[model samples]
Target: MFSEHRQRLVRQLPAGAAALLSANDIMPTNADGTMPYYPNVNVYYLTGLPEEDAMLALFPGHPDPALREILFIKRVDQLFVKWLGRRADKNTASEISGIRTVFYTDEYWAVMKRVLPLCSTIYLHTNEHARSENETQTREDRLLLACKQLYPLHRYERLYPILARQRNAKTPDEIALLRKACEITEKGFRRVLQTIRPGQTGMQVAAEMIHEYMQHNATWAYEPIVAFGADACILHLRANESVGKDGELVLIDAAARHQYYNADLTRSFPLNGRFTPRQRAYYNAVLRVHKQVAQSVKAGILIKDLWKISNNLLLEELVGLGLCTTADISKHGAQHYLNKHCYHNVSHFLGLDLHDTGYHDEPMPAGAVITNEPGIYNEEECIGVRIENDLLVTENGYEDLMKTIPKEAEEIEDLMNR
Candidate 1:
């Protein structure tokens, strides 16, 4: 998948265009210390380069073949390596990434200037995708502006949309890694099921998941969300506390990452190891929608249409539960303030990013992996329920990646009790 992605990005360029991608900067937490380093997804996708401040440039279809793909990495000094820990040397970077051409950071401009004149249009990368709304700044953002000023006449284009389109469908190897990630998530989910009880704290479950993840050479794709009762009503809740009372439903939305591929799963169980009547009703409704969505997830199904189907099912279930009626849905739109307790959309694209980048308007094709999670939350009832499974779209049908994870109330209760 990584090698194919590198070639695909290179293919985007014409005979004489240069494409450049930058690594993520070491973000500061406070004071002199810095937060943990997060690799840029694009760089990781192309070259599997995880270190900070690395740069990759691909001058595809060049006249001289020596300048196809050039990688610039941080120079490793003994003192810096001792303090900041080991950084990749040029030879090490080349060996690991399978990119033969590499140089020190000091030579980036010199190399770019040598090849810049050979290419007419410079494909400058920026976080211009819709998901970049939350980004305040980026290393590529600064470099793009500076490059444009330095060479005012060069034609510059945004690479986010281009890369996003290419990354929508997974390659065979990508699907394998994604499946491995889901397997790790299954292990963690099973661990929680055996360990959870009425008095257990949310953080304890989080700790257990991390322990399992470390044991299996995996890590949480994102922060594991362990919310109980009213806490689950607040989607994206992160307060891992033991304040949840017995008999409340504990909602756990967690996943693990394997080699940069991601898996996402959400399961809600009871604190007392058995679902109450209210919880069971809502949980079953959501599960029905989840199954229906997975069943319908074949080639040529638009994501928006899938959401509409899931929402309609939820509306029917709401009416069944006496929470809302057909007239209520008719009078108010889906954004009906009354139904705000209804959690966010059913599911999203799952891969490198938790909310992976992909085209939603077009029908999802085979070779794509997505989540089918249906959830309902009621603050007044102090109950929230969600059931999720990772799905891989296939030519014949869809396969549930997290199939082994228990979602049936009986199975969940049995595991929790045991």
Candidate 2:
């Protein structure tokens, strides 16, 4: 699978170009302990090897066939394995990455010295996400600086855009992994539904989800959002400290990751297992918009168009609920009026990262996976209703990847009470 990804990237590179990708650095925590190491997504995409200090160099048009693709991994010794377990050996690395040539970290500079001179352009990967605000220097960042200083004549090119474009469309294997992630996430949601009660802390609900994910050999895609009542209005709420009160809605924006592929799902249900009339009204309105957006997903649809569709639907719902008027729409526009109730967009690309790659401006192509999330937050009423599901764009329309997961109001009530 990773070999296919690398080949796709190789096809995009210029004839004389070579690309370099580095795994993530082992970030330091308090004193000597280190934060959990996560391999750089780009590196993992190319090599499928997950370890610190791992690197990949791709020279598609190299003179020596053996040197075209090389993978560098951390060297393992008896002492090292005793503490941190065994790292991928040469054969194991080769099998996983489909790159025959594998070298230890120590040999990387020597190998690069030989490969760099033959390439005119060096493609370096960096954090190119629009929301990326990385302060700590990654191993890739350091490599980029060193390469520029060492070889002044080599033209440097951004590798992120090329990879992002390729990664936007899911391959069959990638789709399978994403489905597995969603299935794991469904287990977490079901468990939480069964465990949740009025007195349970938001942290407890998050713990139930995390426990389910870990049991399935998966992990959290992002920080789980377990917001009860008003906290759901805070889009990025991560401090799961509040208690769920009776009659309040508990919004869970959580997902599970399988083999680095992710599934993002959000479900809001009554803490006491039955939505009040007002809560059901808000929830159903959001669900209606969410369903419409999911149905509208198809090839050649621009992401902005989805936002327009969602905004229009939300505005209508708001007007019907007497939250806004036609006068408000005319003065502030439908989007502005809808923003008073729902502040965020209804969709985002979903895959490896929660907010995965793909340009929002570009037309969504077949195989692109996205989230259809329409939400309404009424601060005065202390109600926040969000319903999210993963959709895979198809030639005809879209397939709801999370269709099996229960999202209906009655279904949630029954599951919770059961």
Candidate 3:
């Protein structure tokens, strides 16, 4: 699978192009404190190795087959073994990545000096995701600057755009991992439903989810968002601090990560295992839009059009619920009238990252994994209803990967009460 990812990039490269991707830096926190290390996804996507300070360079048309593909890792010395506890040796790195030519970091400059003079263009990796703020410089970002200073003349291309096109579509291996992640997430949600009670704190419900994922040998794709009452009105409320009363709603937005692939899901439940009349009414309305929008997704549909379908359906439901009228929407723009309740977009590309890399304006392609999440929040009434499911786009339509995870109100009530 990793070989196929590398070959896909090679197929897009111009002749005499050398592409380089480096590992992420170990970020530091307070004095002598460092955050957990995560391998650079671009490097991991192609090489299947996650060690820090690793480097991968691909020169497709190089005369030397050995230099055609090379990987660099920190040398397994006594110091490294003593502190970091046995980083991958050259042999192990090659064994895992299937790259025959592996070198120590000390050899990188010598290797690159020899390879770059033979290539006409250099492809470099950087965070090109549209939503990325890029406030801090990255290891790859520094490499880009240094290459321009030293080589000075070779044409450089952005490798991220090429990679985005490749990574946006899931391969068979990637799909399998995502499917497993969704299944694990399903287990976590089920754990919550079985144990959560009306008197429990929101964090207590969150603890059930964490414990379940840990048992499955998985980690959070992101922190769980478990909010009760009007706290749900704050979209990013993650503390799960307050107590959930018998009549209030608790929204749990959480998922599990399996083998580097992630699934995203969100569900709201009543603490008493049965929604009040008003809560059920609003919940059913969101469910109506969620179901319809999910069915409308398929290959070749413009992403914007999907948003339009979700927005129109949600607004019409609100009007039907007598929250507002057609006249109100027309007088004050549709968004202005509905923004308080339905503020966020209904879908996003899901994969290695919760919001994975993809062109926002592009058509939904076959084999792409995406999310369908439609939500409504009423701050005054302290009600928030969001139903999310993961989907796989096919030639004809989409397959709900989370189909086994119950979403209908009756299904949830059944599980909780039983």
Candidate 4:
């Protein structure tokens, strides 16, 4: 799976370019402790190694075939192995990554010196996601500074854009991994359906979901959002403290990360296993919009139009729900109603990161996976409903990856009652 990914990247590099991708730094905590190291998605995509201090160098135009691609990983001594268990050896790395040449990270600079003089252009990796922060300097950042200082005259190129575009389109292998994650997510939701009830704390509900994910050798893709009633109005709920109450809804936005790939899913259900008349009204409205927008997914469709389609459908529902009138819409515009009760952001690409790297404004191509989450939140009325599902765009239209998960109001109620 990874060898093909590397060749996809190499094909786009300029004839005389050398590309470098570095692993993430092990961050420091408050008191002599270090945070766990997360693999750099760019490097992980290419090499599949998650060890700290790892790096990947590619020189497609290099004269020697053996020097064309190299992967460098940390070398551990016996003492380190005794304490921390086993690490990937050179042979293991090569087998996992399909790259024939592997070296210890300590030998990185010496090897670079041999190949740098022969390449005319250098490609460096950095976190260029729109949501990324600039607060801390990463290992990749340090690498960029040193490479520029050591080889001052080399023309530099950005590798993020190339990788971002490539990652937007998933391969069959990546799709299979994401599907596995979705399957795990379904297990979590199914467990929630059987156990959730009034008087349970939000954290307890999240526990049920996490239990299923961990049992399947998966972890939460992100922090679980288990908000009950009006607490669901918090878009990104930070604390799952609220207690479930009869006739109220519990909104759960959680998924699983299996083998580094992620699935994002959200569902809202009644605390007592059945929605009240008003709750069902609001929930069905969001479900209708989710279905309508999902039909719009295909090649050459602009992502912005998805928001438009969802908004337009939500607007009509708002009028029927008596939240607003056509006259009010004429006066306040759709934003007024949407801003008050719903989130206009309907979809986002999902993969390694929860919000994956495809450009939102452009026409999406086949193989793109996006989340369809249409939500309605009314804090004052103590009702919040959002239904989210992962989608895979295809040449014909789209495939609902989470279709088997119980989503309809009748289906949810039946599973809970049974």
Task: Provide the lDDT at 161 for model 3.
Answer: 86
- Per-residue lDDT tens digits of candidate 3, residues 1-418? 8999999889999988999999999999999999999889888888888888899999999999999999999877798688879888878888888899999977898999879999999999889787889799999989999899989998999998898878989999999999999999999999888998888887788888888898999988888898888887778788456888888898889999987889999998798899888988988999999889988889888777888899999999888778889999999879985687899889988887788888878887898998998899988899988899999989889999999998888899999999
Query: TM-scores for all candidates?
Result: 0.96, 0.97, 0.98, 0.98
Name the runs in model 3 displaced over 4 angstroms.
none
lDDT of 4 by residue, 288-341 (tens): 989989988997898878988888898899898889999999999889899998
Q: In candidate 2, which residue ranges exceed 4 Å CA deviation?
A: none
Pick by lDDT: which candidate is best? 4
State each model's C-alpha RMSD to the native. 1.6, 1.3, 1.2, 1.2
lDDT, residue 227, candidate 1:
92
Going through the candidates in order, what is the number of backbone clashes in each? 0, 0, 0, 0
| Candidate 1 ranges with C-alpha deviation above 4 Å | 337-339
lDDT of 2 at 349: 91
TM-score of 2: 0.97
Better of 3 and 4 by lDDT: 4
